[model samples]
Target: DPVVVLDFQSLYPSMMIAYNYCYSTCLGRVDQLIEQTEFSEFGCIGLEVRKQLLYKYRNDIHISPNGVVFLKDYVRKGILPKMLDEILETRIMVKNAMKMNNKKQNPSKGLNRKLDARQLGLKMIANFTYGYTSANFSGRMPCVDVADSIVAK
Candidate 1:
């Protein structure tokens, strides 16, 4: 028997935006010492606390279990998430244009084809953002940790 599988088209990118998982949110390596090991009692720590805590924290303090700590709130928003949001938005606009154009009486094939190409390009860019970080290239930082964290998410 054959089975049909359903998947969310923009799952990865959506998760990134939802969790604010970007390079900017990364608070770098946790310290070896624990000068202050306070639970998240009051609330999630802000950027100010992040700076203070990074100096002496044995374990990951943030709410996320993805090996990387993120800012308590999306007040500033990360660069990667912002970029991905634009790309996804553009794709949606193009897709909508293509769909609406195809349903028109005239149905301009050229416009529809152009929209389709643009949508595909945006998709490739959004999907490859994660791979770009993981690629073990000399020019890049080669952050397998960040890539692995993304997978863990």
Candidate 2:
């Protein structure tokens, strides 16, 4: 099978936007911003994580111009997709469990219940994947499929 070379064009940027409340910063109330954003309870956790990643991988190591690291050839070919799949699977499990628990806890809220962990996980994975696929190419890392193509050669 010809492996699909999925790319996250602006993963870092999108991550940054989400983490920083960029949309709200432009024009949104605090409540609206909090409600509309994901992972609000985590506060600056995402920002901190992004900073650490950039500092370690992008700045210190100087991997790319935009301060986003690309998966190495070996990692991309051998490990990345597996990691993504694992993430996806875990998300599904969490979401399902959460749904069940919520339903049992409040039967009245069943119809209006929000998604649990698994659903969040699935959304996270999907968003990450989509970001990668739709990222702009300018001043960003170029595509490299040597990893995905490893099995073909």
Q: Using lDDT as the measure, which candidate wins?
A: 1
The alpha-carbon deviation from the true structure for residue 88 of candidate 2, after best TM-score superposition, in angstroms, is: 1.1
Total backbone clashes of model 2? 9
Candidate 1 local Cα displacement, residue 14, angstroms: 1.6
For model 2, how does the per-residue alpha-carbon lDDT over 36-116 read when each residue is reduced to its tens digit?
A: 433322211221123343344332221222222233333222233444555556666766666666668555354424545
Off by over 4 Å in 2: 1-77, 102-118, 130-140, 144-153
Mind sharing the TM-score for model 1? 0.73
Q: Model 1: per-residue lDDT, tens digit, 38-92?
A: 4322112222234455545324334345445655333457787889999999899
Error of 2 at 41 (Å): 43
Clashes of each: 0, 9
